[model samples]
Target: MTQHVNEFIQQGLRVLDIERAGIDDITPSINQDFAQACELMLNCRGRVVVTGMGKSGHIGNKIAATLASTGTPAFFMHPGEASHGDLGMITATDVVLAMSNSGETSEVISIVPVIKRLGVTLISMTGNPQSTLARAADVHINVAVQTEACPLGLAPTASTTAALVMGDALAVALLHARGFTADDFALSHPGGSLGRRLLLRVSDIMHEGERLPKVRHDAIIKDALLEISRKGLGMTAVVDDNDVLLGIFTDGDLRRILDQQVDVHTTSIASVMTARCITAKPEMLAAEALKLMEDKKINGLVVVNKQQCPVGAFNMHDLLRAGVI
Candidate 1:
C-alpha cells in the first residue's frame, strides 16, 4: 500500500511537470495568431458566442467571462442547448468562438454548420488542425499540446490548460487593442473589491456635514480634543473663520504635546496643530488616499476642496467599511 501511494504521488508530479512544459511550448503559437484574433474580435459588432462540450465547456465559460469583463462582449452557450432553439442566440453580426481539444467534439461541430450557414464569423480553438471544426472555421487557432497530463493519457489536463491560456491570450490582446481602461473594468465588476477600490472616490466614503471632525483654529486644544472624541476619527481638522482648512491635530500631536507639558486649556489648536498636513481632494480615488496613509504611516486624513476647505474626514476604519482597504 505504501509503494502504491508513492507511485501515485510520483505520477501526479510528472503530470504537473508535463502540463507546465506544454504551457511553455504554446507561447510561440500564441504570438502567431494573436494579432489576427484581436482584429476579428475588435471589429465584431455583436456578442462573441463561445461554445464547447464537457471539460472544454468549463474552460469556455471562464474565457467568455474574461472576454466580457475586459471590454469584449461575450457569453458562453452550451453546444447541446444550441440543438434545442438556443441557435436563435446567434446572428449574422456575431462571432462564434468554439473550443475543443480534438477539434471533433460532435456537439460543438454540429453547431458549426448552422453558424456558417448564417454567415457568422467562426473562430475555432483546437489541437488538431485537420479536424472538422477547424476546417469549417473562418479562423483556426491551434492550441495543441504534446500530451495529456494524465498518466494513462485519458484525462483532460494539459489540453484544457492550453485552451484556457489561449482564450486568455485572445481576451487580453483584444483588451489592449481596444484601449480598455481600469474604469471600464470597474464598470464590469462593480460588486467586487477591485471595482470598489477603482470606482469609489474620497467623497463617496468621507464623513460629511455634521459628521466632519472639525474645529475653528481659534478653538482651544481641549475643545478640539472633545470634537475628535465625539467624531471618533482620532483627529480633528482646524479651519479658519471662513471655514477654510488651516491645519490638523491628531492623536500623535496630542502625545507630543503632553510630552512637552503643554497646557491644553490655554493653548490654542492653531499654535500646536501640524500645518502643511497631507490632504486629499474629495474627487480623488479612495484607493489613492489609502496608499498615502500607508506610505505616511498614518491612519486618518481630512478631505478638502479646491480652496483647501475641510469638507469631510476619513480613516482606515472608513476604508474598511467602504471595502477599499
Candidate 2:
C-alpha cells in the first residue's frame, strides 16, 4: 500500500484504541449519578426528551432510540429545533437527557432556561463535570475521558464514546428495573427480524385448514406424495380417521422407500411413515420452534392442538419467509 494509506490506517486504529480506553476509564464512575438518572427516568410520567447539538445530537438520537426500544419512553429533540417550536414536546412530567462533551455546547446550554422553566427533571451526560451543563443539571453523569482519539484532540471521538456508553448504561439499568422482556422489546421494534422471532407464534405462520398437508391413515403412498407436492412443504402428515396424528412421511422417507423398491402405487403411507415425529404446539413461540428444529436436526414441524391432532404444519422455509429465521 501507499505510505499515505498506511498512515491513515494507523491513525484510524489509534483513534479506536483511544475511544475504547475512554469507555474503560468511565466504568467506575457509573455509580450514584447513574442510579439517580435511572430513578429520574423511571419516575417520569411522560417521556424522556433527549437534546444535543451537532455530533452529540446524532449520538443523542441513537441513545433515545435505544431507550425507547428497551422500555423507556424517549425521543430526540434537536436543540436548534427546540429553540424554534419543538420545545412544546417537553412536558413538566417528562425528564430531559442532554448530551454535550464539553458541557458548554452553546446551542444545548442556551435552551436550559426553557427546560428548567418547564419543571422537567434534567440529567446531563458530559465529559467535563465542572462545565455549565453539568452544573445546571439535577443529576450530572460524569462521562469523563482522558483524551480524544483524534490526533489533534479536536474531534469528538473518545468523548462521544464515553457519552454513548453512559447512555446505554442508563437505558439498560431502567430496562431491568422495569422488568422489560424480549417480547416488550420486540413490540417496539416490529420492523426488525428480532421482533418477528419474539412476537410471532407458530399459529401465526403455520399452514392451517386446507393449506395443511395431511393424509388419512388409509392413504396410498401415491396420494400422500401428491398431497405433499400440492402443499409444497416437502412432507405430508399421516393421521387417523379422527384427525389424531399418527406419523409423518417426508421427502427423506420417500428416498429411503424408493431405495428398497417399495412401489409408490401399491404402498400405504402408514406402512412407510415414521411415528413419534417431532412436533410443536400452536401456542409456542416461533423462536422456540427454531431452537427445537436446530436441536432435533429437522426442518419442519406439525403444530398440534391440545388433542395432539395436527392443526397446522410449517417448515423452515415458512419461518425464513416470515422473518422469523
Candidate 3:
C-alpha cells in the first residue's frame, strides 16, 4: 500500500513536469498572432464572444470571465448552442475567440462559416496550425503542446493550461492598452477583498460626530478616560474649541502614566497626552491606512481633515470588520 501511494505521488509530479514543459514550449508563440488577436479584441465595438465545446468550453468560460473583469467586455457561448438561438448573441461588431486543442472541435468548426457570415472577426486558438479552424480564422494563435500530462497523451491538461495562459496574456495586454486601472477593476469587483482594499476610504468606516471620542485640551485626565470608555475605542482625542486635533491619550499612555501615579482627576489631558499623534486623512484608502498602522506599530488612528481637525476615528477592529485587514 505504501509503495502504491508513493507511485501515485510520483505520477502526479510527472504530470506536472510534462504540463510545465508544454507551457514552456508555448512561450515563444506569444508572437505576432497573439498581438493581432489582442488588437482585434481591443478594437471590438461589441462584447467578445468566446466559444468552444467540452473541456475547451470550460477553459473558454474562464477566459471570458477573466477578459470581462480585467477590462474587455466578453462572455462565453457554448458552440453547441450557437447553432440554436445563442448565435444571436454575436453581432457583426463583435469578435469571436474560438478554442480547440486539435483545431477541429466539430462544434466550433461548425460555427466558423456562420461567424464569418455575420462579419465578426474570428481569432482561433489551436494546437494544430494546418487544421480547418486555424485555416478559417482571420488570425490564428498556436497554443501547441509538445506532450500531454496524461500518460496516454490524450487528456487536455497541458493544452488547456496553455490556452488559459494565452487568454490571460490577451486580457492583460488589452488591460494595458485600455489603461485599465486598479480602481476600474475595483468598480467591476465590488464585493471581494480587492474592492474593499481599493474602494473603501477611511471616511466610510470611521466614527464621526457625537461618536468621536473627544475631550477638551483643558479637560482633566478623568474626562479623557470617560470619553475613551464611552466610545469604546481605547483612546480619546484631546482637541481645542474648534475641534482641531491637539493630542491623543490612549490606553497605552494611561498604562504608562499609572507607573508615575498621575492624578486622573487633576492632571489636564493636554499635559498627559501625546502631543504629536499619527493621523490619517478622511480620503485615505483604508488598506493604505492599515499599512500605515502596521508601519507605525499602532492599532488606532484619528481621521483628520485638511486643517488637521479631528473628523473621525477608527481602530483595528473596524478594519477587520470592513475586510481591509
Candidate 4:
C-alpha cells in the first residue's frame, strides 16, 4: 500500500509539471496573430461562433461561455453538426473560432470551405501551425506543447490544458478591450452570489418598519435590550421624540454595562450607547456595506435617510441570509 501511494503521488506531480510546462511554452503564441484575432472579434457585428471536435469541443464550449459572459456574444457549435444544418448559425458578419489539437481534425476541416464561402473571419487554435486548418485560417494561434502529460502520450492532456489557457487569454483580452465592468458582469450573472453582492442594496435586505429594532433615547437599558431581542438583530437604534437617530446600543454594550454594574431598569439607553455610529444608506451596495462593516469591525448598521432617521436596520446574519456576506 505504501509503495502504491508513493507511485500515485509521483505520477500526479509529474503530470502537473508537464502540464505547467505546456502552458508556459504557449505564452509566446499570444503575439501578432492573437492580437489580430482579438481585433476581428472585438469589431464583429455578430456573435462569435466557436466550433471543435472531441476534447477540443469541450474546451470550446467553455471558451464560448466565458466569451458570452464577458461582453462578447458567442456560442459553441459541434463541428460535426456544422457540416449538417448548423452551418446556418454562422453569418458573414460573425467570426468563427475553431479548435483542433492536430490542426487536421477531419470534421473541423470539412466545414472550412463553407465558412470561407460565407466570408466569415476564421480564427484557428491548433498545436500544428503547418496543418491545413491553421494554414486556411485568417489568424492562427499555436497552442503546441512539448509532450502529453499522460505517460502513454495518447491522451489529450497537456494539449487540452494549453488550449484552455489560450482560450482564457483570448476571453480576458477581449473583455478588457470591450471595457467590461463589474456591473456589466453582474448583469450577466444575476442568479449568482457575485451578482447578489454587487446588485443587491441595503434597502433590499434590511428590516424596516415594524421589523426595525429601535428605542426612544429616554428608554431604559432594559427597554433597549427588549427591542433588540424582539427584532433579533443583536442591536437597537436610540432615537429622540422627533424620530431622529441619536445613538446605537448592542450586545457588546450590554457586556460593558454589566461589568460597570449599571442599573438596566433606570439607566437611559442613550447614556451607554455608541453615538454617531456607523450607518448605511438605503441605496448603498450590499458589497460596499459589507466592506464598511468589515473595516469598522462591527456586525450591524442602522440605515438612515436624508433626514437622519433610522429607516431600517440589519446585522451580519441578515447579510449572510441574503448571500451578501
What are the lDDT scores of the predictions, listed in order? 0.92, 0.92, 0.93, 0.95
Off by over 4 Å in 4: 192-194, 240-244, 291-297, 306-308
lDDT tens digits, residue span 19-51, model 4: 999999999998999999999999999999999
lDDT of 3 by residue, 21-58 (tens): 98898998899999989999999999999998999999
Q: Against the true structure, what is each candidate's TM-score? A: 0.93, 0.91, 0.95, 0.92
Could you tell me how far off, in angstroms, the CA of residue 257 lies in candidate 1 after the best superposition? 1.2
List pairs with backbone clashes in candidate 2. none
Model 4 lDDT on a 0 to 1 scale: 0.95
**Displacement of the residue 209 alpha carbon in candidate 3, Å:** 0.9
- Which ten residues in a row are the worst by lDDT in model 3? 147-156
Off by over 4 Å in 3: 192-194
Error of 1 at 271 (Å): 2.6
